[model samples]
Target: MAKRRTTPKELPDAVREAVDRTVQATRGSAVQTRERAQGAVDDLVDTVDDLVKGAEGRIVRGRRAAARAIDDVRPATNEDMRELKAELRRIGRRLEAIEERLPAKRPPTTRQGAKSGSGSAKPRAARSGSSAKPRSAKRGSSAG
Candidate 1:
């Protein structure tokens, strides 16, 4: 029985072929891994987008509900204030028109140092000659 021996040139060629086969397998595996990673990243992005949309919807609904609650608690609306203001303006105009049609009366005048025939009663403080301040002066001093 004769055993076949490998030549020197054949050994190097076999090693090169094995290395090439390993590189090709590694490249194929790398491409598959990259594709799977990209798919996972796309799914994550989609899920995040859906979550953001849901959150936005909830926020809008909450804002609308808050506005409704505020409206329920408020005393009057903008429209009501506008109507009241318009009614007041109409009444003021009517009063002015009525005043223009009526006759004007002169205010009564009193002569200085002339005693009128009206009530001659004096205040108790003035009759007693007390040094206490008058009610009007006290009110004026306190208000300031």
Candidate 2:
């Protein structure tokens, strides 16, 4: 008893319809899988974008904090030095203006002419003639 094999050209109508239905179902399933995969990829891209933005924000904040910490420990910035120099120049200009407005200083003068001979002048003690010691000398002697 040999078994008979069916040829494609001689296939039953029901079997052919079943095959077509399976192929259509497979195509539909493949299209759904592709759509789901594309959606997953889009979601992953959006999540990555959000993570990158968050990381960038954190980096910026960290840099700012580091700069502030450095500023706190530093003696002065260039801007501060420039301000100090400007203030010093302003003070110097003000001092010069004040000096210009003031009267000139002159050497002290005596009643007699400066050219008078030293021999003609009497000693201060002899002119005053009072023999009492100066207050400062008396105080020094008493303290000693």
Candidate 3:
């Protein structure tokens, strides 16, 4: 129920032209902002590309370092294995030599009095030097 009629304020033509100029300037600034954003994106892409290339170079260097490290240890590792094998052989030989120098085991002595049969063998004494009997006649033959 309240429809009031208001008086219209008059706007100047110069003020309207100034407002249009301000809007045009704002549009031009928007275009410049878009161009700046595009330039920033291009710079960022270049930085990313450089980072990838640098990382690839570092990876190549790391692989080369790993290969060099393996090569550096190869000779030493082989030498260590060889030395270990040689030491094992030396220990085995020393053990064999020790066993060879061990004294021989003798059989138990027999009782001459316990044998009453005629098929019994004679008992011989242990001597260091050769006997007065010749080598052939010593055992039984006359070939000496």
CA RMSD of each candidate after superposition: 17.4, 17.8, 17.1
Best-first order by TM-score = 2, 1, 3
List per-prediction Cα lDDT, in the order shown: 0.86, 0.84, 0.78
Residue lDDT tens for model 2, 1-144: 999976666568779899999999999999999999999999999999999999999999999999999989989879999999999979967876887799986754576666656554666666888797764575577743
**Top-TM-score structure, candidate number:** 2
**Which of 2 and 3 is the better model by lDDT?**
2
lDDT of 1 by residue, 1-144 (tens): 899976888898899999999999999999999999999999999999999999999999999999999989989879989999999979967876887798975655667887876634665567788998754576578743
* After superposition, candidate 1 runs with Cα above 4 Å error: 1-7, 77-144
**lDDT score, candidate 3, position 72:** 85
Better of 1 and 3 by TM-score: 1
lDDT of 3 by residue, 1-144 (tens): 999976455556677899999999999999999999999999999999999999999999999999999988876677889999999979967876887798975875667786656433543432434456643354376342
Query: Best candidate per lDDT, number?
Result: 1
Candidate 1 accuracy as lDDT: 0.86
**lDDT score of residue 75 within candidate 3:** 65
Q: Which pairs clash in model 1?
A: none
Model 2, residue 86: what's the lDDT? Answer: 95
TM-score of each: 0.51, 0.52, 0.41
